[model samples]
Each structure stands twice: as structure tokens, then as C-alpha cells.
Target: MSSDQVKNEIRRFLKSDDKLALCLRGKWGVGKTYTWDALLAEAFGNDTVSPQKYAYVSLFGLETLSDVRKSVFEHTVGAASFRETKDLEATFSSISERVAQLASKWRAGIGIIRGVPVVADYGGLVEAGFLDVRDQIVCFDDLERMSDGLDLKDVLGLISFLKEKKRCKVVLLLNSDALKEQDADDFRVQLEKVIDINLEYDPTSAEAIEIAIPNRSTLRSRLVAEYATTLGITNLRTVFKSLRICERLEEVLKGYDERVISQAFHSACLFAFALYQPNDAPPLETILKNRPYSDLFGNKEEKTPEQIQHAELLRRYRFLKVDGLDLVVFNSIRTGVYADELIKREADLIAAQLDLNDKDAAFTKAWDIYHDSFDDNGEEFAQALKQSIAENAVAISPSNLSASIATLKQLGHGEGTNDIIAAYIGSRGEGKEFWVGDPILPRFNVEDPDVKAAFASKAAEFADNRTLEEVATSIVRQSGWDNSDLDYLDQKTAEDFYKAIKEAKGEQLRLLVYGLTYFRNVGNPDPRMSSITTKAIEALQRLGRESEINRLRVSKFGVEVPAA
Candidate 1:
């Protein structure tokens, strides 16, 4: 029912004294009881209004009809006297006053009913405190949670008695979805006979959100509602919890712009919904690639069942292509790493914005400053330098390259430092100028032998796949051989080239030797290349192959052969 219809029905139920019961049933957390209580508060001004009594009893663990009877009697008020009273105490006082008046009319030691002695059963009278629930609004909550031994027909029978005999306005607040299979079937069969009105407690989205997040004006609340609706989230508990997470995120992400904050909020909502709702979240890669979003909402032609499910999951959340969020955000949603990285990156950007000097390494330099300030042993400085170098190498920032190189000079022999340096140099063009001058490497370094061989073998493989000139050009560009700081790498490459020729099989050996001769003359003019050419000449001559030697001299190098 619409909120208006439900409201009108509840209003009618409260005002009318008809011998009928109203059943309010819904899925969990859709605010069924909340609505009912709101209505009660509206009608009575407070729960303890005079005379027209309100009783609430939860049948959650009631084991038998006796327990139900006791609960109703205890919860009910103003049963006997029709006069309005302030509280249960006033109602009990009115009953007690009537008893006193009757006691005054009787003799002190004798009581009679139909000329016989009347013995009062005090226990029974106390047990039956207030069963006459005339003019009372009684609610039986958590009906689905009622004990297994308390049969459904039995509970309905009690509701029937409250309406027929007690003349009370009864309401059954239940989550039918939670009902056990047999009980659910039996409840359907039995509720029909007893219930006068079945009002399925269908709360609207706005109503649900209002109940879940009372502070709807806040950005966190607004975003949660928007996201819940977009994702098509209808479960009030999940919505409430998701909004709570957003509230926490808002506090933590206070400094970021709304766009960034909203992104984080949205990501958090996706994660929360996936946890709370029924979904088999696809792998992070699938979401990261936009495949899931595409399969459901994009132009992707082929669709698998898993992809379809992923799409539907997003759709249920009202996620559409027009939302314009990056696919990577979904990845961030699934694994916290993405969001953490985003926050870190944003922090860095913000810090950079606030930094007075365009190049402030104040935080990074703090380590050095601390060591110098203490005049401590250089161990701390050395360790700091090592960390700075390693961090810079992996990230390879042009801004910090000079500082990193200076640190590397002190900690160059640290594990994997050489590889980092090699990779840094290897990434540049052989002729490209270093951002800092060649004195960058104070301690001359040897290229790792494994690195040298791999470079050579890879170059040879490239030669077989492409022209030798192209291979030479590519390696020279990549290895930064022209930079004097990296000349040793050129020499190492030449040596590795010689080893490759010796290990190469017949045709590959011929190609390796030829490629080396061309590299000597046409590639970087390092003397290492000249030495490698000399070695190739000697190796071919030792092979007693004049043809190969002359070919290296004329066909490749364009140099005249010295008489062998």
C-alpha cells in the first residue's frame, strides 16, 4: 500500500471500536513497527495517555497460551473501570478502590456467595490482572519469532479472542519473510480466518530513508539516499548501515573536495551493499575493466551469465553508464587498496598545493635533518639515504632524481640498488642527457652480469625478428649509452655480445657476429664496441672461415680486413 493508504487505514483502525484486528507485515527493516509506533505516538500524544490504554507484547519466545495470556494481562491497562486514568498505577488504584468498597459492605470474618462461604483465590486473581482489554490497542510483535511450540493457529486464536471477547483493537507486527516454511504456510491459512484487515507494510523509499537516516539534510545522508536509490537498495537496515559508513567517511575525508569525497562515499556504498545485499560480486579485475558495467549497460555484444549477473547487480543499485564514474572505482570498492591509494594520491596533491616552494622535500628531508641535529653516528643518515634512494628508484620522479642519485652513491651496494640504477639508466636514450650531470655516479659501477647477458640475448633475439640496425637503434636509445655516466654499461654490453656469439648456434652465431660488427661502427662510438668488433674478427679468423671474416669486414662494418 502507498503511505497515504496505509496512514488512512491506521487512522481508521485507531479511531474505530470495531471488533477487528489489523496485521502489519513486511520484509525486515522496512520500518513496519516504526510506522505503527509513530501512529500510536500521534494518536496518544505519548505512550502513557489517560484511559485509552496501549499495550505492546512481543511473542518472540512465548512457549504456550499461558505465556501469551500473562503477557497480554501484564501489558494491558484500564480493563474494568471505563474511567480515563493517567498511568497503570491509577488504573490499578481504581480497581483497588472498588474492592475496598465491596470489603466494607461485608462482615469482618465471613463472606458469602449464594449463602455459602466465599474463599478468595488470591493467586488466580493476581494472575488474571487485566484480561478485559476493552478500549485498548494491543500489538503482538515478532510474531514470526514466536516459539516453535506456540502453534500459529493458537496465536491467531488468541488474536481472535482479543477482537471477539475483549473488544480490543489488535495489531500483528510481523516479518513474513522470516517465517519458517511450515509456519509460513500455516500462518497464511490461519491468518485469513482471524485477521479483519491485512495491511502489507509497504514503506515508500522516502519514508524508509527518513526512518533510517533522520538527518537527511547532511551530505552523508543525502549521498546515502542517492546511492541507495541509484543502486536500487530497498532494505532499510543496509541503507542505514551504508549511510553510517558514509558518515564516518565524511569525517575522515573532511578536507577533500566533494567530488573526491563523493567518489569514496559511492565506493563505500557499493562495498556495503555487496556485503548486505544478495550478490556474488564479480572479480575486481572484471569490475576494473568495466566489463560488468558494459555487459549490462554498454554496447558489449557477448554476455555470459556471470557478466549478466554483475550487470544486474549494478542495475539494482541503479548504476548506469551515464553515472560517468571510472570503472577503477568499482575495483576500489571491492579491494580497499584502490581507495587508499586514491586518498594518498589526493593527500599528496593537496600537500603539493600547500607547499610554499615548488620543490619542498621537507618531510623526506626531515630524516636527514634529524640525524644532523643530533650529531649522531652516520648510521641513521645512511639508512635514511638508502630508503630514500630505494623509494625514488621505484617511483623514478624527475623532481627527486638528483636527490635519489646522491643517496644512491652512499647506499649503492644495498641489495637490488644496482638493478634499480641499471633500470633507471636503461630507461633513457643512449644519447639523452641526464637531468643531473655525469658526476651523478661518484663510484663507478659494474653492470650486473645477468643483466648484461639478458640485454645481449634480447638484442640478438630482436635482430632475428627485425633488422640489426633497428635493434642497434632501439638498444642505444633504451640503454642511455651516450651518457658518460653509463659508459661502463656500454662496455658490459660489448662483452655480453662477444659471449652471445660464442654460444649462438650456426646461423644465429653468424647473425650475432654480423649484428655486433654493425653495432660497433653504426651504434654508439664507445671504444667498448670497437673492442667487441676486434673480438668478432679474431673469433671468425680462428674459425678458419675467411668468408665470415671478410663478410664482417666488408658486408657489415665497411672496413678493410687486416691480413689474417
Candidate 2:
């Protein structure tokens, strides 16, 4: 039933004096207990319910019938006292008075003296305490989590007794799907005898979000609610977690544009759901490693079930893109440690890029040829595209640049592609740092051969201009090398390698030595790697002859060096 329908039923159950048990059932973490408690609080405050007393007990660790009896007595409170105050001492005093009255009555009936002990043992106290449970409203929750020693038949028998023998109103809260197969069968057989009304408490996604985040006046809360509903997240626990993550992100992203905050909130919602509800969302490793578009269109081999599900989720939600800021959000959720400065730094960069995009409105509109309409405006689009490239080539990302070049070629404006490429390359400042290790070329997707040749030529110029020390320093700082670094190493002579090694000392020397010889330690070195290894060892051997410490350090590589 919907939340409103279930709540109306609960209100009716509260007003009637019928001696029957009601069962509220749902999946785990769907707010079964939360809903029941909120309704009870409302009923007590409004003075519209029939019951004068209330008792709520969770059967989580209760092992015996005696434990259940004691807990119900302890948790019971009068209606006025529930609305007036939540003082545990006052509630316990009321229960103590009732127990003393019951003990005195038993003593008088047995003709025992006033000073004599009426209760002989703890079992006597337990029985007398349970006598106060009659004619009051009681709720039993977490029935599936009760100890294995407590049999289902016995618990059901207790509920039946509360209704038929004691004349009390009883409510049971449980997650039936969480029970084991045999126990579930046994529960079904026994439940029919005791329960009069069984309400399935399955709230919709929006309804669940309303319960989880009631105060959605803030921008962060509204965005979280919006995306969570779009993703169809019905688990109230997951929604609560997502809200908490977004709250932290809001604090970290203070003083930023609303658009930046919205983007971060989107990432926070997806990452929080993925962490808490792995079955419904993709795995964190998959999300962190794969680009959404690549996952959708780049697979040539057969797709796995997980990949298919991920693609469908992305397509359904229209979350077909991600960026560096998303990675910051994912790490914050996974590690529970938000690097506030780093987050603000990323947000500031995004804010600047967004402002730039806003200023280049015509540049954005130029792409409308593909999206806005299809009225055969090829000539018009070509002129607009060429003008936009000329005006905003510096601001265009590599992927968008590739798309623009490809689009211009399609419109028979092939000659303009070179000018666009030149403008883009010229805007990149005069340094080799732009063409450093591992540029993401796959995302470029440029099909034009001339454009490809331009990028390759620029890369070669940068690589050739780089000195050996610059290459070694880059490798040492990152603690890893790429193919370009290996090619640079391949071009150097042994004397060049030795001179570079001879000029270095201390930690830099150690790191450079390790960087050069890393492949040798891993074994099955490539031929280029083996040649580099040979040259590096020869350099180290020459250096080792200068000092005993150097010889000792070189000996660790399984090479003995003679002292000078």
C-alpha cells in the first residue's frame, strides 16, 4: 500500500478497541519502524486514539519468553506521560508502582504478612510484571532478527494470547523476505492464525524520499531528492546516506556557483547510491575506471551482464558523462575523508570553465545544427562552424575540437580543418609540458589524417626537445614511466647516460637508478628495456668504483662492484 493508505489504516486500527493483531511488513531498510513510531507519536499528541498506554519492543536479541515479558513492562508509558515528557525515570517509577501493587494483591490473597516476601524468585516477578500488559497497545518490531532459540510458534502464540486472552491491541513489524526458507514457511503457517490485517508497507520512490528528507527547501536537498527519484531509489536508508554525503559536499563547495553545486550534488547522489546499493547501481571500481560514453559505445567484444546493466542505467538516467570532479566525490564517499581544499580547487576550475562556456554562447549554439533541427542547413552550419572555430578554438576541448573538425569535413569544408587545428595548437603556450606523458588520445576520435599528422608531429618535436634530465626527473617524480619516456631512454648513448648519473647524488640518484632499472627487477624485460637496463647498470658500475657506499648500493642489484 502507499504511505497514505497504510497510515489511514493504522489510524483506524488505533481508534478501534478490537482485540486483534495487525502486521506491518516490508523489505529491510524501507522505514517500517520509523513510520510506525512517527504515527504513534502523532496519535499520542493529538489525543484522538483510544489506547491509554503504549509499549514498543524490538525482538532483536530477546532469547526467551521471560526477556520479552520484562522488556514490554520496561518500555510501557502512559499516554499523558508520552506526550508530556520522555523521562525514563518517571516511566520506570510508574512501572515500579504497578509491580508493587500486583505484588501486594498477591500477598493479601495468600494471607501472607505485610513484611514477608510475596515474590519467592525472579520468575514470580516476571509473571507479575507481565500482568500489567493487559488492555494496552503494544508494538513488536524486528521479528526476523529474534534469536534462533526463540521459536516462531512461541512468538505467534504470545501475540494470539495478547489479543484473545489479555484483551490488548497488538502490532507486529517485520521483514518477511529476510527469513530463512524453512522458518519462512513456518511463519506463514502460524501467522494466519494470529494476524487480522497484514499491510505491506512498500512506499514509492518519491514517498520514500519525502520520509527520508522532509525539509527539502535547501538547494542541496532538492537536488538530492530530484536525482534520487530519477534513479528510482526506494530504500530510505540509502536516501538518508545520500543526503548526508551531499550535506558535506555543500559545506565544502561554499561560495561557488549554483551550477557547480548542482554538478557536485549529482555526483554525490550517484556515488552514495553506488556505495550503499551496489546491486541496484554499478560497482565503484567500474564507475571510477570507465567513462560512461566509452562503456556505451566502445565495446567490441561481448558485453558482460554488469556492463549491460551499467549502460542501461546510464542511458535511462541520461548520465552519459563524467569528469575530474566526479572522482573527488567518489573518493570522498568511499574513504569518508573529504579533502576540502582539493575539492574547492577542482570546483573553482570548473566554475571558470563554465563561465567561459557561458560567454561563448554563439560557440555553443553553433552545434545546434545537429541537435536543434534537421532542415538541411549544411551551408549555413558550415559557415557558423567555421566562424565559431575561428572565434573559440582556444576554449574548445580536444574531444569537441575533433568533433568540429570531423563535422566540417563532412560539410565539404576540408580546407578549413587545417586552420582550426593550427589555431588550437597555437593557443597551447610555448612549452613541451602540454604534450607530456599519456595524453588521452582515444577520446580525441579524430578521423582526419592531416589532423592526426599534426598532433604526431607536435608530439615528436616535444619529445626530441626534452633533455635526458627532464625525462628522468618526470619519471622519478611520478615513480613510473610511459612509452615516450622509454623511447627517450632508447635514444641516449652510454656516455650520455653515465654523465647524467655521475652528476646526480643522494635521493635523486637513488630514485633515478630505481626508475631506470625497474623493468629488470620485474623480469622478462622488453628488448628496448633490456638495452636501457644494460646501459644504466654500466653507468652505475662506473659510479660504484668512486665510493664504497656506491658499491654497496650497487651490490643490492646482484652486481658486485670493485672498490677504486
Candidate 3:
């Protein structure tokens, strides 16, 4: 079910008193939280009571078992009139009591169930009091931490109590990729009434490319391919996390609350556009969010030297070289000296050897090159291919000159093709070879069978339009994000807010807000650091100087801040 459908289902779930949970699943950059907020809005109209009718809590730092109990206790305290609430006990009894009273209320919205900062047996206090509230709905965005380590006790208890005890509607927003196989399966089983609302990132052909510079498309392709290698992930989930792609993108992505989650999706988009766009830039008021950068995104693979090399091959291109240096790839693992020299000499090499292969002898010559490149050295060829895959060093698609791989295949390389195929994916593009399409280095050989299959999967997803979810789980590694400080799009992410003020009438565009919030704590920030761009820093300086805009309080965007 879509976010809207899930919103509608709340009423049915409430009326039926079904104990099943509503899990909104997808990958990061895919917008599970955004979908949840949309659902929440559908369930509850615009009103301050959004906080009162429903409660919103993030199990972000839920470290120990106590953290789990504490989160539940703090989030649901005001709903009960049980034993004097004080630590975990206050939460337990209060929650138990709240469940008893849930059926009595019908209205709903998100609100903190506030009581004594220190737990006290606090009687239930619904903040806004149901205003035409029909059924209660509770929504959780980026619920990665709360559901981990700890058993089905607290969270399950909360779920169990809400449905079995309280009879209120519940929605758990999650990027499916963040969820491991076990966790996802468990969640699916628990939600019982699972509603799947998969979404895609890249819009249709109708979705015009907003920013167009001279080589902008080329730049983006290179950068994306570069980031693709950095994350060592071909899936979309890794796209957003790619520091090369977004550069502390999560800084503007502020949100734990439902509506805010929706906004963060736009923030992610804003960062992408801002980085790629030229000349015009977004204002700080329109760009930054009030929340801290967070890792609520679950497990992600850390970029390694190899992956970095992978990124380099995808983005950079060589024109010509000085000496005999092979600087064909830059901004990757094997850059600098030799790499830089290679890039500098590419054009010259091609020109100098322009007559290396004569088109007049095309078929025979091309055939000879193919065989000489791989024929006898089977193991060497396989190893070279494997290196290509791992290094993101292979770009294949027929041929470059008049002789393309397609023509060769037509002539039948057979097992020679199969051996080449095995080397591509498993090796992750290790060996550097010829160019085909897109200029990125170590490109996925579309001709390789395994690569063909992987590309097919990506194409299928693209066809299905679910790139957002695809990005979420793509970079995942052993352990997921812990103690997430997510700020789903705050004021800065509301591209719609300043669109009227700047360029057009209601042209929504999120700019970088507090662009360095995630990086501020560093004493000596890296000028050539992996993530920061000189351009982004300049944007921050301009935004930060505006007193009127920077003076805005954190609360406006529904976020908490450190004391000055």
C-alpha cells in the first residue's frame, strides 16, 4: 500500500483493532519516512494537534536494553495514570494504562507525550485534545536503531500495546535496504498487515534536468560513476551516501518526525542539484536545516582505497600525458604522479598512435588485437578481468573504433567471451582497458554476462522507478548506523518556501542549510578533505553571514540544538 493507502488503512486498522503494525519499507534516498509523513498528513490534517493525537519518538541512541525501555517510557509517558512514573517503571505502567484508554479516543496527530522530565506517575494528558480526530495514528521515520539488538520486548511491547492494548493505528517508516534480511523478514511478519509502497528516485523523461551546464551531464555521469565506485555499490542506495556525490548531504536532511522526513527527500535532491548547477546558487535560508547530521541510514560500506580508485575510473578522463605516465584515471585510488601524467597524455597517445590500427584492415586487425589482448594468457586474462571489476577499471560496450565488441561477439568469441565475463563482475573492473560509452573509467562492461545481469537488474529497477529505495540499502556493510542524528529536511529543505522569493513562483528547491553542521566540530577542517568542496564552503560563508536568516531558531524546523 502507498503512504496514502496506509493512511486510509489506519481507520480500518483502528476500527478492526488489528494488532498488526504498518511498516513503510524502502531504501535510503528512497523516502520511506517521506512516505510515512505523507501518510500521517493524510490521516491527520494540518493542526498543532499533530503532535498531540499521535506521538513521535526515535530510538536513535537506544544503546542498551534500558535505552529501549527509556525511549518507550519517555515517548508514551503522559498517556497513563499508573504508578508514580520515575525511571523505566513509570513508562511501563503509564504505557500499560495508555493502552487501556486508547480506544476511548478517536482523533490523532503526532505529539510528544511529555510529563516530568524525571518520570512521575503522570496521568494522561493529550496535548491538543482530539479535534475532529477520527483514529489515532503513530508514525516512526528512520526507525533503524530502535528495532535492533534489543529483542521484541520494548518496541514489540509498544507495538503490541498500541494495537492489542491501546487499539490505536501505528505506522513504522523504514527504508527496506536499511533492514537486513533477518530484520526485514521479522518486521514483515510482525506488521502482519504489511503495506509495501516502493518509490523511484529519478523521475520520468518528462522530469526535465533542472541544471544544465556545458559539460554538466558529462560531469554528473563521471561523478555518479565515481561515487558508485567509492561506495563499491552499483545500487542506488549508495548514491546518496557517496561523499563525492553529495558532500555531507545528510546535513540538510533533517527529520525524525513524519512531515520532516518528507522534506528530507527534497533536501537530498537539493544537494544534488546545488553541487552540479553552475552560476546561480541557493540562499542559506533556503538551503540549511536545523538538525545535526545523522547516520539513521543503517549499515553502509565504508569507502576503501580500492573503491576510491573505482570512483576515479568512473569520473575522470584522460586527455594526454607527459612522459610515459598512465594518468588515464584521476580522483581515484591510483591517482597523482603516474595517473596525473596519464590523464595529461591520453589525447597525445591516441594521436601519436592514430595509425596503430588501419580501418582498411579492420576485421582482421581488430580480431588480432582481441586475441593478443587475451587469447593465450587465460589465467592472466581472467585475473586481469577480475582486477577490472574490483578496481572499477573496465568500460566495455562492443568497441571504440569501427570495431565494437558487438561485432566481435557476432564473429563468435564464445568461451573467450565467457572467461572475460567472469572476470568483469567478480574482479569489480580491476584492469584498465579500452573505452566504450560514458567516459568513466573501470566502467561496468555491458558486454560481460554477469555485468549484463547486474545492469539488467539496475535497468529493471530504473524501469520500475524505484531508485530511491535502491540507494538506501546499497552501501550497507556489517553494522548499520548507530546513534543517528538525522535532521530530515528542516526549514532549509522546503525548496517551496523560497522558490517564490527567489526565481519563480512556487518553484520548490532546497538549498544547503547549515551545510557544515555535520562537519563543524572539527578543529582543523581539511581543505582538500574527501567530502568538502570549495564551492560548498563558499555557499556556507554567504549563508552564515546573513544575521536575519541565521537567527532563526531551531524549534521552527522541529529540531533540538546545543546550548550556545
What's the TM-score of every candidate structure?
Answer: 0.56, 0.64, 0.29
- Residue-level lDDT of model 3, residues 394-458, one tens digit each, is 33233221123244354443335444444443433322122112323233234544444543333
Query: Clashes per prediction?
Result: 9, 0, 75
- Point out the higher-scoring one by TM-score: 1 or 3: 1
Give lDDT: candidate 1, residue 256: 72
User: In candidate 3, which residue ranges exceed 4 Å CA deviation?
Assistant: 1-20, 38-52, 64-66, 72-136, 141-149, 175-189, 193-237, 241-564
Candidate 2: C-alpha lDDT: 0.79
Using lDDT as the yardstick, the better of models 1 and 3 is 1
Per-residue C-alpha lDDT of model 2 across residues 173-261, encoded as one tens digit per residue:
98967888888898888889889989999888888888888898889788899999987788888888888888899899988999999
lDDT of each: 0.59, 0.79, 0.36
For lDDT, the strongest prediction is 2
Clashes, model 2: 0
Candidate 1 Cα misplacement greater than 4 A, ranges: 46-51, 77-126, 279-290, 293-564
